[model samples]
Target: MEEGAKHVVTGGGPQSGHCRSVSLICRPLGMKPHVVIEGVEKREDLGSMGNTLLYRMAGSKLYLAPQENYESFKRRVRKMKQYVSDTYGEKCYCIPVGGATGKAVFAFISLFDELLQQGLHDRFDDIVVTVATGGTSLGLAVANYLTGSKLGVHAVTIALRKEEIYENMDKLLKELGIDSVKSADILDIIEGYVGERYGTATEEVLSFVTEVSSSTGILLDPYYTGKGTMGMVGELVNNPSRFKGKRILFIHTGGIFGLFNGEMDRVINKEKAVTNDITPWLDENVSPVSIEQ
Candidate 1:
């Protein structure tokens, strides 16, 4: 369906599962392609659960560029992969940040238009998205610019500093060919959720994860969704009157890490295996759901 999708390139950062997910698309999504993965962050944990799956499925065609971070990876892998991207002649399939800005923003605009037509757009006062590499958050920023949508777009930054995230968003906006737009009028990035270093979750983060999953039945991986939700919930609860009777849409940046060292992680992983054992509870009384105002 996509040209130049045959070769997948990614920053195999240990912090997020995005690159790992990108690897899966190479085989099943289309033709058999060569994958060049750049392992930017080299921790003792070595690789992620995603890296493991990518290695297993990609086979011999997969080329790995393992290094400490950006500079090292670029030096080791980037220069050699010039022929990988048909469009850029340098980049791989997924750019995660600037590469996806234009595409992501335009896609969200289509969704926003549909919501407007259905009269569903009036409900939300603010929109929050999980920000790691800035693609998703910056995407909504561009959508706001193009549509002139009144709904506020906020980012719950997961890893980077606020200044860095904002700077990246501005750079991405320019790269998306939508320059000279004022970010203050369109986007707000909140940086109250970094907790510790990337992939290092504190006790509070795990607690929040357990509470939300138990309450909403939403599986939030530690890296993105869990931290993102924690940031949103904290704001709403602390300043109740500010968002009272207002609907704020929190975007769940989905992943499949199955978070570690928490009760939710154990249950999330174990429940599938023991589902037959809980057959009696399966038919328990449950009411049908309806759209909430």
Candidate 2:
């Protein structure tokens, strides 16, 4: 964006992290953020919850539109941009759905550079990350190709098909003036983890997420990280030889807020025993401290 840009626009599903991030970033920069939500018809149904609540808290303007197609959504965003300019007399920068543009890929490239700086570039044999619009994984793949590292980038597809992600990667490659290399050659797209489509999770998967959070203290949302974890674990369980001696790093992108979006009730164990017993902690070596004022 230019120095004095007044408004920004982006589009995605209701719980899109990218849209929420844009709102957060824009607010701190004195720029107003506008989000064009997909498949939403009424404002009331959008509801103040999940990423939607975060967007509102950041003072983002919401525009609901139908998910007819990608091109149609783009057209609607263009119209929104025009409206912002005409109505407010200021330029509005529009971000594509998922921020899956060529420029956005560089953000992950920088992230990969940070990993190299932290001496983690060669510590892992495989990197597992969740993929929706594919920008993040493409950036990592570009970094891997540039650095000549041998680590594999496994992108678990939670929404789009493999071909769709590949297409997005190819477009990004063109933006970087690269040729003679195909996206599939550098990126591994993992599928079959999207249980009931995007933003939907089965009870088994949710239970797995609960178990993981309880054990590791890392909360994995059903939308992305949970599915990515399942895909990685499935690979290791089904084909142990592939990761027998290799160290795998699963990228835990933060989507914890989605867990509070009111779907966890289906996975809660109502019959599980709850206890507040502290007798086990009281031993002969244990003592309490006394303070005097």
Candidate 3:
């Protein structure tokens, strides 16, 4: 398995308090399992938790969590952090991009809680991280600040225009009661990988997607996975020193649905066309009887 890539295992059901459970077994080139997690799930219950409470606390905002369980948001974050640390290692951090799902926030807070439990309070030394343009980035920044960890979060983004991402991230941090949250330019880290449009597939990303599927039989969502994998690869290529000969983990926040619909249809159509073009000889082999007109 390559460094800074998500590896997922099949054959597991959803776990309580978690959206789903999948095993991540990471064994560096010549080393033992450097990182291993037994169960990881996206909390689907977040949507039904109610928006009224969220609106009351943070005002009627489209992105903030709903009012009902909005307060439990802190507890959820702690849970996620504990899950990662218990299964993986204390150094493990849940890296997720801010998107429509709103699960990353839960995951970030969970990590913070785990850190506190582990009593590793002053270990905030140049930890590498990744965030995207959305609530996930904001939540992560907030969690990092709460833990007082020095982070180098790569804000991976395709949607939310650059200026908008900056402003939104700032607003989110302030709202979450996190004052000092530093960030790095995601585009600068992934300049040529974004392709033509937001959520659109690029040649490099598609190739990487195909490679992962063929080699490891792991599927990646087109929009986020494709972009995120591209970002991770670019980071490894450019800043080899940060992770050279060291074990690094890339959090694979699930989003298989993003690969379906329009983009998947296009990919299917293209593949069918190629298959048809290559199998022209099969058409000649099948002889047909002539019918009288």
Candidate 4:
């Protein structure tokens, strides 16, 4: 578990969402994650979330990654973490976004297994999945690989470079013992809706998420689900007939806690808090009428 892991925290970004969930679950089992952060201060929520997780869940505090762009921030964090790990001789397993190939593949297989068992698999013409680290997307791509392209398992790039993403998917299949499905075979990458960069959600993006939440009671975190859903909706809305016989099923991997970050909180709810103008502070009004201390 220590080879790919470090004490450092990286939950602020969308790709880091999966990492956060994994760390939280594994922390109680004596795995204390600690590392230094450097330049990753693009959004208020990223900082707030990192610190909040450290305070409530672990014995250590969060370190800010250096203030570089998303890619550079990741690089700096990785280098610092390696330095610490090598110095202290700590081991961490660095699984990719969907817990590597086997897990990712099985996740989709299991999902579709149940759906197919329930007589629900034949209803969809397409399955829209998110490709953050190419974990789950690659898995579903495997499923599509098995289906011989009957079920359109298209992945939308929410973060990272699309080229590397497809490559990762190809590698994941190879790791999963599926030798035939190449990148070009099982890859259908949709781009242009990442909202600037990782962990950064645009105003329009938040609006759609809020609307979806209000209407369906299915909350979507901004980074992963929000971006993927927005992309799917935009495509379907703009070109209805393109998928006329197609039933689009958008898969939402759970990451609700990521929504509590500062950036998300800012746009999630604009309604004022319920209050009676109740005095929240002690009477500093005793300007001249104060008793001797």
Better of 1 and 4 by lDDT: 4
Please state the error at residue 280 of candidate 3 in Å. Answer: 14
**Cα lDDT listed for each candidate:** 0.59, 0.82, 0.42, 0.62
C-alpha lDDT of residue 218 in model 1 = 82
Estimate TM-scores for all models: 0.71, 0.87, 0.47, 0.73
Quick one: how many clashes does candidate 3 have? 15
lDDT of 3: 0.42
Which candidate number has the best TM-score?
2
Q: Please give, for residues 1-293, the per-residue lDDT of candidate 2 as tens digits.
A: 56467999998878888888999999778899999988889878888888889999998989998766655776788788889988899988877778888888899999988988977655778788999888899999889888885688888898888987898789889988888688998988888898877767888778878889777788998888888899889888886565424788888888887787777778673345121112343356866432220
Candidate 4, residues 142-221, lDDT tens digits: the string is 66667566676777788767886766666666677778658656667778888777666887887777788877899887
Best model number under lDDT: 2
lDDT of 3 by residue, 209-276 (tens): 65676567777766566667667677778875643233433546555544433444444435433312
Higher-scoring candidate on TM-score, 1 or 2: 2
Q: Residue-wise lDDT of candidate 1 within 190-209, one digit each (tens)? A: 77788865555665777677
Candidate 1: 10-residue stretch with minimal lDDT:
272-281
Model 3 TM-score (2 dp): 0.47
Q: How do these models rank on lDDT, best leading?
A: 2, 4, 1, 3
Stretches of candidate 1 off by over 4 Å are 1-6, 29-44, 47-55, 60-77, 83-99, 239-245, 260-293
Clashes of 4: 23
